[model samples]
Target chain A: MMDDIKELIEEGKFYFLNQKYNEALQYLNKALEKDPANIEVLYTIGIIYESINNPDKALEYFKKVIKIDPQHEDAIIHIHSISENQ
Target chain B: MERFVVIGLGRFGQSVAINLAKLNKNVIAIDKDPQKVEEIADFVFQAAACDATDEKNLRDLGLKNADVGVVSVGEDISSSILITLTLKEMGVKKIISKALSQVQGKVLIKVGADRVIYPERDMGERLAKRLSSPQLFDLIELTESHGILELLAPESFVGKRLDQLELRKKYDVTVIAVKRNVPKLKDDGSTSFKESMILSPGPDFEILLGDIMIILGKSKGLDKIKKVK
Candidate 1:
C-alpha cells in the first residue's frame, strides 16, 4: 500500500513538472484518498491549484496540509498568500 | 563614516537622526526641547538640547566639520532659514532643509540649502498612488519619466514565457527581477517556503501566479502595466 502511494505521488509530480495540471491532480487526489494525512500529496495538489489560479481550492488543500503537519511551512506560506490575494 | 548634524527634534528630524545612527554613522541630534532631545539620546551618538539658530552654539558643536546638516524645524520658517544659514556659513558640506511650501523651499535654497524636502507632501502622494492602483506594490522614481515598479504578475503574464510576452517591445519595460516563494524540502523532511529572487530571468523564463515582478521603465509604460488585470 505504501509503495502504491509513493508511485502515485511520483506520477503526480511528473505531470506537475510537465505542466499537465489536470493529470497531476488526478494522480495526487488518488494518493490523498489512500493516505488522507499525506503531506506531499496535499502540498502538490495545493501547488497545482495555486498555479491554475484556483486560490480558494488551493487554500483548502494547503489548510489541510497544515492541519496534518503543523511544520509544513510551504503550506502555511501558501495560505497567507491566498488569503492576502483574496 | 559620514557625520550628520540634525537640527530640530521634530518627527522628521528624529527619524533622520535615528536612521543615520542605525547605519553606524555619527549623528548629532539637536533640539530646543529637552524632552525631545532626551527621547532620542539613547539612539544617536550625541543628542543636545540647544537653540540651533545660534551660530555660536552650532560652531561650538563642531557643525562645520560634519559631512551633512539637516534642518527640520517644523513650521518655523525663520528658525529653519536661520539654521540653514548657520550651517552653511560654518562650512557644512551639504545642507538639507525641510519646507512646508514651495515658497519656503525656494527661500531655503536661496539661503544656502543644498536640498529641500517635503516629507508630508511626498507621503501624501505615495498614499494616493497606492489607493488608486492596487496592483502596484511599490515604486521608486528614477527620473521624471522613468521608475522601478514592483507589481503582481498580471494574469496574461502567467503561463507565458518571457520571450513570448514581448514586454520590452510592447510595454518598453525591462523585467529586472522576479520575487517568488518557492517550496523547499527541509533536512528533517518537512516542507517550507523560501523567498527567492530571480535576477535577470532568461528569455525562456515563465511567469507564475503569485510572482512579484520588479520592472524598470518609463512612467507611461509603467502606467500601462498597472492597468493590466
Candidate 2:
C-alpha cells in the first residue's frame, strides 16, 4: 500500500510539473484518499490549488496540514500570505 | 516630442515634472526658490530658478515655444493666476493649473488655464471610496456616469464560466480583463508564481478565486457589483 501511494504521488508530481493541473489533482486526490495523513500530498495539493487561484481550497488544505503538523514551515508561510492578500 | 514647462516647484509641480521626465517627455521645471530648482535639476531636462510671473524671464527661457504649461503654485492663488495668464500670453498651447478651491479654479480658468485640477480633494475622494468598498482595487472615471474599475472576483463568481455568469445581461458590466497569479514549476522542482493578464477573455473562460477583474460599466452597475459577496 505504501509503494502504491508513492507511485500515485510520483504521477501527481509529474503532471503538476507539466502544468496539467487537473490530471495532477486526480492523482494527488487518489494518493490523499489512500493516506489521509500524508503531509507531502496535502502540501502539494495546497500548492496546486493556490497556483490555480483557488485560495479558499488552498487555505483549507494548508490549514489541514498545519493541524496535522504545526511545525510545517511551508504550509504556515502559505497560510500567512494567503490571509494577508485576502 | 512635446515640450512641457512646469512653473512653481511645489509638491504637486515637482511630482508632475518628475513623472513627465520618467515618461521620456521633455520637461523644464522652474521655481522662484533656488533650492527647489536644484533638487529637481537631475530629474528633468531643465531646472531653472526664475520668476515665472515676469514675462521677460519667461520669454528669455523660451517658454513661448513650449507645447504645454503646468502652473502648480499650490495655495498661492495670486501666483497661480499670474502664472496661468503669463503662460497663456506666452502662446503656450495648453495650460494646466492647480487650484485650492472651486473659486480659485474658476478664476484660473478665466485667466486662460485650459484645465484646473484639485489634487487634494480628488485624493480625499479616492481614499473614501477605497475605505468604503474594500473589494475595489482601483477606479478611473471615464465619464460622469461611467467608470473602469479593478475589483476582486466575488465568492459566487469562482469556478463559473463567463457565459454562465451573464454579467452583461445581469449586472450591465463588461469584464475587459482578468489578472491572475499563475503557478510555475521551477527547475529545482519548487513552485513559484507569476502575474498574468488575460484581455477580453472569451465566454468559455472560467472565473478563478483571487482573480482581479477589470470591468467597465455605468456607475449603477459598478455599485451593484461592489456589494457582491
Candidate 3:
C-alpha cells in the first residue's frame, strides 16, 4: 500500500511538471485517499491549484498541510503571500 | 504632502527630487556641487550645496524632519552608504537608496534602508519582458505571480463579447479597461489619433480588433492569453 501511494505521488509530480494540472490532481487525489494526512501530497496539490489560478483551492490544501504539521514552512509562506494580496 | 530630502545631484537624484516637487511635495534637494544645486534650485522647495555624508551638514538642513530621504549616489558607493547611514541616524522615517550591485543592495538594507533600487537592472527586466512579448505594452507587477498587463487584443478574441469569452471562468483573468484609438480631423484638416478609454466595461461589452486591453490576473493566466493564436 505504501509503494502504491509513492507511485501515485511520483506520477502526479510528473504531470504537474508537464503543466497537465487536471491529470496531476487525479493522481494526487489517489495518493491522498491512501494516506489521508500526507503533507507532501497535500502541498503538491496546493502548488498545482495555485498554478491553475485557483487561489481558494490552493489556500485550502496549503492550510490542510499546516494543520497536519504546524511547522510546514512552505505552506505557511504560501498562505502569507496569498492572504497579503487579498 | 510628504517632505522629501534627495541627496546627490546625479541624473537619478535630480529626477527624483524634481518629480517629487512637481507632485506638490516639499522637496529639499542637496548635493556637494554648487552648479548642480543651482540647476535645480528653481524647481525644489529648497536647494543646498552641502556634503550629504556629514551629519552636521544634514542636521543643519533639518533632514531629520523630512518624511523620506533618497540617496542616489550610486557611482560612489562609499558616499551613498554614508548618506544612507546619516539619514537613518537623523530620524528620517523612510530611506530609499540606489545600489550599483547586489552586494551594495544587501549592505544598504543592513544599514536601515527601507528600499533599494537598481535602475539599470529594473529597466533591463522591463525591456526584456517587452521584447519577448511584442503584444504586451506594459506590465505592473503586483506580486511575484500576479500583475496587471496592457496588451493588444488578440485576433482570436475579436468580435467576442465578454460573457461569451468566459475570461474569468476559462482564463481566470479580469478585464479592467479597454482603450481604443480613434481618428479625428484637426483644424487644419489632417487626421490625428485620440485615445478613448472604457473603464470596467460590463460582460455584455464586445471585444473589438485593434483594441488594447488592460487586464489584471496571475502571470500564468496572462501567459495563457499571450499564447492564443
Predicted candidate 2 versus true structure: per-residue lDDT over A2-49, tens digit per residue: 999999988988877666778889999999999999988998899988
Writing each residue's lDDT as its tens digit, candidate 3 over A29-70 gives 999999989988898888766544445787999999999999
Can you tell me the CAPRI class of model 3? incorrect
Q: DockQ of each model against the real complex? A: 0.10, 0.19, 0.01
Q: How far is B177's C-alpha from truth in model 3 (Å)?
A: 1.0
Question: Model-by-model lDDT, in order?
Answer: 0.86, 0.89, 0.84
Best by DockQ: 2
Candidate 2 similarity to native, TM-score: 0.66
Pairs with backbone N, CA or C atoms under 3 Å apart (clashes), candidate 2: none
List, residue by residue over B104-166, the lDDT tens digit for candidate 1.
999999999999999999888876876686567798999999999998889889889999989
TM-score of each: 0.65, 0.66, 0.66
Task: Compose the digit string of candidate 1's lDDT tens values, residues A2-46.
Answer: 999999988887776665667778998899899989988888788
Which candidate do you rate higher for DockQ, 2 or 3? 2
Candidate 1 runs further than 4 Å off: A1-86, B138-147, B181-195, B217-223
Model 2 off-target regions past 4 Å? A1-86, B138-149, B183-193, B216-223
Best candidate, TM-score: 2
